[model samples]
Target: MTHQRKQIGSGRNAIGDFAPKLAELTDDVLFEDVWNRPELSPRDRSLITVAALVAGGDSDQLRFHLKHAKDNGVTESELIEAITHLAFYAGWPKAMTGVATAKQVFTA
Candidate 1:
């Protein structure tokens, strides 16, 4: 499947300045290629990405992905439920952090 390059955030632009090749790979390979695979819908990919970010306590990336998740059709209730369900396995602290991040994303 082919996809238009996604404008994820400033990180890609910053990386592109220093390492254009890496940035190309990120934009072309990761986002365009892998993320656009027809096997998974964008919403499903958002759910998986959000869960990974939440599990790893990656609030910085989580912030971006949360917005993407909502744009991809993941509902507020679904995001809350995912975080709540992950708390037991990923840790309460991480889930708590996710909740705070979610609030910021949802409110914004």
Candidate 2:
């Protein structure tokens, strides 16, 4: 719990009251409840989240999730393939944006 708080609230040097509660929900519900589900692996979830973020043009959040995706075993090739596949159905622009995000992720 302390470790989670330290990581999440460290940037601003304060918990901001809501930080604790946010951490609780993130730790207890977000991670433990949904992320830990056996039906989907962490890697798969990260991949999906990154893709959604890319589609939504949420680059700031996408960058974080891209790193998470890489950490969880989402390879560059796999990301490229996913974006390429998404290009057809989800629209080229969105897919292109995903490719740009992937490029940043890979370069970093």
Q: Pick the candidate with the highest lDDT.
A: 1
Instruction: Give the poorly placed runs of model 2, Cα more than 4 Å off.
Output: 1-23
Report the Cα lDDT for residue 44, model 1. 87
lDDT of predicted model 1: 0.86
Error of 2 at 39 (Å): 1.4
lDDT of 1 by residue, 1-108 (tens): 655334343436768789888888878887777787778888889999999999999999998898888888889999999999999999999999999999998897
User: Mind giving the per-residue lDDT tens digits that candidate 2 earns over 1-96?
Assistant: 111211121212334265777666766676667776667777878878877776776777776777777777888788788878878877788888
Clashes of 1: 0
What is the clash count of model 2? 0
What candidate 1 gets wrong by more than 4 Å, as runs, is 1-14
TM-score of model 1 relative to the true fold?
Answer: 0.84
